[model samples]
Target: MIITTAGRSPSKLVMKAKKLSTSYGLSYKERGGVSIESLKEQYQDDIVVVGKERLYIAPLYDESNLFFHPNLAMIRAKRMFKGDEDPLISTAKLTEGMSFLDCTLGLASDSIITSIAVGSSGSVMGVEGNPLLYLLAKEGLSSFSSGNHLFDQAMRRIEVFHSDHLSLLQQTKSDSFDVVYFDPMFHSTIDSSSGMNSIRGQAVKSELTKEVIKEAMRVARERVVLKDHWKSDRFAQFGFTQHKRKTSLFHYGTIELN
Candidate 1:
């Protein structure tokens, strides 16, 4: 993917893009004439830009431009911090001073909440199989501001990697983390789930096979959690004991270790 600034823009942004291009091994281009339509015609492929504060482009799935936003993740984290329970916290059974791994980082909403639940002394590692999604989420987690310092702090603490979770799990030592989690994108979702549409293009469309659970169990000291559609058969198929909440579209399947 090529990185470009907004509106054929600033030297500061150009310098920043140059730095990112070098670090990320992406080509940097000048947005001459500031036309995405022209640029798409010029490059003959999908195009996204490193806009002033976020990455944005016309959504592959929708008419609007899609940009990164912590969205409800931040809200839920704030509520959890103020004493309400969160499904992610509940499924992972997180507590202070724990370590957690998020195997499917996606938009990183769950990882952000996991970070908040684990607190300052704890650590959260997020793995993403998609490089573009990784770059977008990693940059968002580091630089996006929500007008809330604590939420932003939690975001900053999350360490995201661009790698397949399976490989990472294989290399991980048993009992290395308090929890290992997955929230793989469902095969399909209801139409109103427009928020995730942008991510669908770059997400790893992998099935959570029994082998995934086995590796997660080995690496986790306490639990391995999978959040999937309530109707999904993965829980029964993979032997994850299921827990469902009233009126929730998703259910948490968990395996607790000794």
Candidate 2:
């Protein structure tokens, strides 16, 4: 992928884009009063736009540019801080000073919440298989501010990595984390939205298999949690006790180690 600046490029942004291009091994091209469409056609590859605030990746095929945003995490975090119980946090049985691992980080919506639940003394690590998604999440977690101190602190504390979940789990020592979580993309269509649509094209849509669970079990000390479509057979297939929500399309399931 090639990197370029936005239509209005300041020196700082231009320098930042060049630095990112060098770091990510991408080509840095001058915007030069050119349209993204023309650039994409010329390069025949996705373009990364380094805007004043955030970095955006415009896929060659899709118009929905993928960027980093906290999305629902900010809302969920506010509710959680206000004493609302979150299903995933409850399912994982998170505490103030525990370690959590998110296998499928995606946009890191879940990881951010887990970080808030775990607090400052605790730890949160997320592994994203997709490189672009990893870069976006890693940078966003550090830079984005939610205007709420608790939520902003949680977002900044997360450690994001680019790796396959199973690979990371295999490399991890036994019982390395208090909780391990997965929220793989649903095989069956659950809902439709532009955000989800943009992610679908860029995110790693890997199957959650038995082997992955085996490694997760070894890595997690307290429990392994999964969030999936309510109708998914994975809960039954992998021995995760379903925590069904009557009104929600998705459910949280868990395999408690202790």
What C-alpha lDDT do the candidate models reach, one value each?
0.78, 0.86
Residue 251 alpha-carbon offset, candidate 2, angstroms: 0.5
Q: Number of clashing residue pairs in every model?
A: 0, 0
Worst 10 contiguous positions by lDDT, candidate 2: 186-195
- Measured on C-alpha atoms, candidate 2 has an lDDT of 0.86
- 101-169: candidate 2 lDDT, tens digit per residue: 999887788999999999999999999897777778888898987788988899999998889888888
In terms of TM-score, the best-performing candidate is: 2
Q: Stretches of candidate 1 above 4 Å error?
A: 58-63, 186-202
- Inter-residue clash pairs, candidate 1: none
Cα RMSD to the true fold for all candidates: 2.4, 2.1
